[model samples]
Target: MKIGILTSGGDCPGLNAIIRGVCKPAIQHYGMEVWGIQSGFRGLVDDNVVPLEEKVLSGLLNSAGTVLGTSRDMPFKRRFSASSEDKPSMMMKTIKKHGFDCIVCIGGNGTQDTAYQLSKLGVNVVTIPKTIDNDVEGTDVCYGFDSAVSIATDAIDRLHSTASAHQRVMVIEVMGHNAGWIALYSGMAGGGDIILIPELGYNIHNVGSKIIERLKQGKPYSIVVVAEGIKTMENKKAAQFIAEEIEYETGFETRETVLGYIQRGGIPTAYDRNLATRMGGFAAQLIEGKQYGQMVSLNGSTIMPVPLEKIAGKARLVNEDNDLIIQGKRMGICFG
Candidate 1:
């Protein structure tokens, strides 16, 4: 049978590994012809593709980013629209013209949404969750999360020395885009004094007071880990704003470091590499069963198939009552 594959939305560390996993088993064992869809959904609409072979999957298990390439999921706008409703129909035509029995879509929430849309349009899609946010529901963890957390935590740890030596409030911004897993894990591991998440909006006044309290307690310096997804109660959050706020409120010098793109460009963490490999292997198993509209997910320690429909509707969030929140409280980390 012929199959099409694509990775969509924000790039992740385990993407290449996933491609290797899927193509290895599908091509070697299932004897299926796999076509790599270039540049994600745009490729689907534009009909850009190439055949994928076992050789193409070689040595990709340890690589970061996707070999199939990727694109954002914004159905409202195609890269270049020829006409209204023409794009979606054209996307459908690509699937038919290529004579693919099914498609494997590896990506995050936005990508899943795109897959669902395609499914509704009569193209069979089997999704694989891929996001560092770890916010995609139905999966205990998604690919690339470990690498991101590791990168953020390492940055936070390294900043401690400089922040302490200079007696400054170091506001470290890490990627989340919509979730707090990166900031939460880094703040906890790196011993950040303040951690901000999008789910729980903060009152900057309280955060300001915490910094002042730290000063009074003889801790002249503070480390603040902020997720890019979060918003302060006043609804103002640009990295520069956080730096200025420290100076304005506590009268202490502050520095800002936005860890944008840095967390995304490193080697895959050991955990991510293993997870990606396994997820890819598991993806092959599902395709073997001829399951459609399903996604491979890691639930606790087991690999499971969940309907792509449910996984697309809601995002998994950090449970407020979870152990991490408790640990943060014991460390006296402000959630503001």
Candidate 2:
């Protein structure tokens, strides 16, 4: 059997690891020919592909980013065009031209949705979820989540010494647009004094009061971890808004740090590399068994297959009753 693979959506650590996982097993164990598709679905439409042999798959387990490249292009979405260009049909032609029996899509939520669309079109499809947000549905955790959390946690840990020395409130922002997994996990792991996430709405007054209370309790410095998706007045960034509000209301010197893309780049942690390898190997297994239209997922401690339809548009979000949040509250860490 011949299989094609592509990475889609925002690039993150563990992408190359997953690709290696898929290619190595499919090439050696299953005796399947593997094709690497460049720049996600756009590559499929443009017929940009290369053969994946065992030698090219080596040394990728510790690498960051994708060797096949990635893009955010949605071929299933309608493009307002004057030309008669049907992207999905063009992708089908490419698949047939290469005689690919199945296409393995490795990406986040958007890529899963696109894979589902292709499956409905009678194309064989399998997916592996990869995202730093950890919001992909039907999975306990995505591949890049642990790596990103490690990076964010390290940043927060480093900021503590500076915050204490300067006697200031330091606000650090981590990525998470629709989910707060990164901020929540990093905040708790890094000992953030106050954690604000989109899942649990925060009030500026409450945030200010928390800093003031800390100061009154002889705690001269505080750490505030903010999710980037958190709503802020005047459309300011979450960390900047929280820092400005803390200084304005509590008269404390405040500083903001946006970790940004740094968290998404770099070699993946050992845990993430293992998770990616497991998910990718499972995807190849599913394809070998002719179980198409499925996505490789981690349920608890097990790596398994989930129907693509079930995972397409859904998201796993942090709830108010989460044990971490409850523990943070008990520890006098303000949620606001």
Local accuracy of candidate 2 as per-residue lDDT tens digits, 1-336: 999999999999869999998888888899999999999999998999999889998899998889999999999896538658789988999999999999999988999999999999999999999999999999989989999999999999999999999999999999999799999999999999999999989888998888888888999999999999999899999889888988899999999999999999999999988887788888889999999999898988998899998878999899999999998899899997
Off by over 4 Å in 2: 80-82
List model 1 lDDT by residue over 99-187, tens digit each. Answer: 99898989888888778877887777888888888889999999888898998899999999999999999999998867889899988
Model 2 local distance difference test score: 0.93
Give the runs in model 1 whose Cα sits over 4 Å from its true position: 76-81, 232-237
CA displacement after TM-score superposition, residue 306 of candidate 1 (Å): 0.8
In model 1, what are the clashing residue pairs, if there are any? none
